[model samples]
Target: MTSYDPQKIIDIHAHLHSDLPSDPALRVKALESLLVEQGLVDPAAIDAWIDLYAEEIGPKRGAHVVARAWTDPAFKAKLLADGTAAIREFDYQGHATGHLIAVENTDTVHNVVVCTLCSCYPFSLLGMSPGWYKAAEYRARVVREPRAVLKEFGVALGEEVEIRVWDSTSELRYLVVPQRPEGTDGLDAAALAALVTRNSMIGTDLLKARA
Candidate 1:
């Protein structure tokens, strides 16, 4: 217990949604497989559950949570202070670790998330990342000098905004929930969600609700 390194664990997934098990068969099957995989169920239910999920629900189901943060500042603070709850505000909640801090990509700092060795992301908010973000070139250079890497990504910020690079260590994971652009005050939730792209949440792009 004394030498426990909590930052050693991280989950970088494409998406995480509760809508995965919509049908009765799919729900039962998914539940069964999850139970067994976690050592919570017996072997008898594994095969049948798999078959049922495949036939009933089809593919894996997951939801995105970044959109909600884009519309609400108080919610955004909640997200920075409590990531799991902030994600839950939209639906696809994630694992609650030691702590989570959300840095807004304003006209000052552009935030990006990466695991130098592996992929680490906030699946609940941004969905899956593109192959480019997970590439070796991105992982290494992005951390050492973020501004340079972002320039390669077609992001050339002026002196107004600072480019900040954060390393998502093993114990704690970070999510870059970009700030809503200056003039997007009137956009509704649904309209705002469309702008909260995976990259925007990762701070690779600006979150623009209006042109």
Candidate 2:
């Protein structure tokens, strides 16, 4: 069996042309064909990965976890204390989430996650990793100039707010618990969940109170 290599996936994408088909489905199919044609990855490996993200899990799981933490102080305490165990409350304990750690965005601190070596993402929780997340530029730049990168993503933090970048590995992954948006005091968990964006959970985008 040919083992899947997340780093190789990045390398393969780096070699793909910028002018790939615009249609999302066709774009994925084109990439798959190119990788298979180049003998860089096996078709089954690609399909298995696609099925894992497309059918089994997504960012909604992470959003609900964040929403729960926002509402339940006890669960928030447990989550900050032991993320892997706390997420099991929602049956979000498997594979990429086995050794999860939750970091909070507070008044003085903000957290962002990156896999400097490869795209070692908690996809089972965060869904398919974004293309930029898997890019070499992001992996290298986010660690060195995090504040600048955050700004580029439209997340401008004051100098007083410390930005911490967490590196993910196969054995461990991170989840950013973004601060609850103001004016959401009456929102239920589901309503709050609907407000959570994947980028907000990734710390690239800040959550704003709905108007």
Candidate 3:
């Protein structure tokens, strides 16, 4: 198995330049430069890949699905019953999403997802996973101290509400359908989708009502 330097990874984020032997970000840049110099990788291609996920294919896909489920009762039922098939109705399918299951947030329950082993995620619908989601701290602490983690993310659930944490794997992925915000009764599907944030879909935050 390949081993990574934990210190380098920590240094990259901590920005402790004084204590570190070398700048982690600069080291990564130098490595990328070397790869480009040797024609082992293409910067443009990498940029294109990042752009495709960040803009073209992103949380908007999941938001559209959520909005559709919210507006259509039959679709919602289908989604709740078989998330994989329901999501396929929109033609959103790709890697790490072999068997999709959607957990819904309600008045009494909330759902969140994480990949303990690695960053196994539904990239097709959710786009790139946030850095925080893949962080070691988040992965280690979320399962054992969910309430505290949620509080750190500014989500304060009531004592009576149930918190469900879904551990995603390469074979089975999960999406959280956040509870619809109040005062959005007259909004159309597109409008409703606009209200859905990436964090809400990740269950780190809730949908806020439009002002």
Candidate 4:
């Protein structure tokens, strides 16, 4: 139950090679070494923090929240009204989720999140931010051309649908509550949670009814 999948983290870090080094791993290693040398960061503390994220907080918590919202009207209302307080019920509050705001997607409206300034994200709930999310291109273009960006992610919306882009900051972050797929009325919370995907929660992919 790692906060994020290791392979995904690797994939995210893989795209970080630019002016530093061709190999991202080497670049990270060098940075860590320098930081350690300057006494700016402790290796053990960093390891502990990584382990905490990898072992405790993750997208599963977000899926659980989504599952409850799908089944409980009251909780869903509360979630949309005050996401920060609603998530505290599960003791899922942590790190970047302290100032969370939940936005729902409907037939006529879609929601997406971006951090135009940096890679700010609800990491405690959504796990680690994806590589593309940290890229300068995404940070710049998502706000200006969200529909086109979403379409590239395989989410095609009709012209009638309004797309809202939320910009996350260090003080506030956004979580998209994707529309629950139809044909899942009989599914329990656990079953429903199993169907939730990180991309859907990020508003990049639309969930389809279970077949």
Candidate 5:
């Protein structure tokens, strides 16, 4: 228990290498070399893991949703009215199952998304929510008032553009479906799709067609 205790040295050594091996693949190799891979964790099992790791973690599959809306009007409407069902149509599922709403972003009325009921993100497909987006400040400001929040995010809207704030419920999570910007006339669907970011799809920003 004195200063000579080996535990203190061990702790210091641990902290020294804490930030090492950031790459998961390298970590796996280290684990294998240390002979701790057995009964430790199956590398293949980790590979088999789908997007499950991203739970309420990311943008809630917003990019895919926006791409669909820009290309298919019917699909967009279906998604806006009933996100769960529309997502199922695309063979995607996980979280926010029972109730969901996808707001349509238009030039006149820009939409930004947030979940005040707890970060009910759809990470099974979207990956992970940005730390700033899932923060308490963003949640509170986005709910109490959205236009101001957007301004803070550097998203300025003119007086003619109305800002709509959407609240996310436990049963129903919402994502922003921003409108497609002009000037991308010749670009194909694939190129257009590339322009759709998860944030834009979730109404956090607008998509500028491949220009």
Candidate 6:
């Protein structure tokens, strides 16, 4: 048998590799498989941990913040003025949430969030970024045509309302505080939290009146 140089093989293969997996989820799954194969971690353990963060801990944390802001004027004022400190009030802190900025949506103005450079999101609060959120098209088009992108997501704004797009960076992360839905005045904080949606928090969707 003849010996082949590994570097030479890799070089040839590199040329053939034109593009990467466009779907971030696919790429993540592939990487996870590789790690599992290498015995660096167990797949079941990784899934359980992810589920805990995504389902149990993630959106619920942000929902609580929104609920409090909706019900408590003082906390809402503090949250808008200083998101990082206000969020810490709930004992939610992580490296991913370094500098948090809460943008409030009102009758006159609406806020949307995006990461143009990369998928830099407040994972601690929002959990995993949606696949569409990490798409190149979204990253590029949302900043340029926010209204159109929002419309596609079934969120249409009035002509009088101003749309402000916040680009998240490594230094700061933004969370959209969606306006409280009408007819929810009687709802308590826990009930209000239940009405909060992940997309509303991301500014891609609006909070509808829950029956």
Number of the top-ranking candidate, with TM-score as the measure: 4
Backbone collisions counted per model: 10, 0, 0, 0, 7, 0
Point out the worst 10-residue segment of candidate 4 by lDDT.
11-20
TM-scores for every candidate against the unseen true structure? 0.63, 0.77, 0.79, 0.82, 0.67, 0.80
Predicted structure 4, TM vs. truth: 0.82
Q: List the global CA lDDT of all models.
A: 0.63, 0.89, 0.88, 0.89, 0.69, 0.89
lDDT per residue (tens digit) for residues 55-156 in model 1: 532111111345566556687678778876565554445432235567766656777877787887654334455788789998988888788878876777
Error of 5 at 182 (Å): 0.6
Task: Look at candidate 2 and tell me the lDDT of residue 66.
Answer: 99
Candidate 6 residues lying further than 4 Å off, grouped into runs, are 1-48
Better of 3 and 5 by lDDT: 3
What lDDT is reached at residue 5 by model 5? 75
Q: What is candidate 2's lDDT per residue for 4-60, written digit by digit as tens? A: 998987777777646565689998887778889999989898679888778768889
Query: Ten residues in a row with the worst lDDT in model 2?
Result: 13-22
Candidate 4 per-residue lDDT, tens place, 1-211, comes to 5657888878767776444786879888999999999999999999899998888878888999999999999999999988999999999888787788899999999999888987888888988888998999888998999988998899999999999988876688888999989898999999999889888888888987677
lDDT score, candidate 4, position 63: 93
Task: For residues 1-211, write the lDDT of model 3, one tens digit per residue.
Answer: 5349898777776875564449789877988999999999999999998888767888999999999999999999998888888988888887666688888899999998998999888888888889999999999988889999999999999999999998875588888999989999999999999999988888899888888
Worst 10 residues of 3 by lDDT: 12-21
- In lDDT terms, how accurate is model 2? 0.89
Of candidate 6, the 10-residue stretch with the lowest lDDT total is 13-22
Q: Write down the lDDT that model 6 would get.
A: 0.89
> Between prediction 1 and prediction 2, which has the larger TM-score?
2
Clashes of 4: 0
Candidate no. 6 TM-score: 0.80
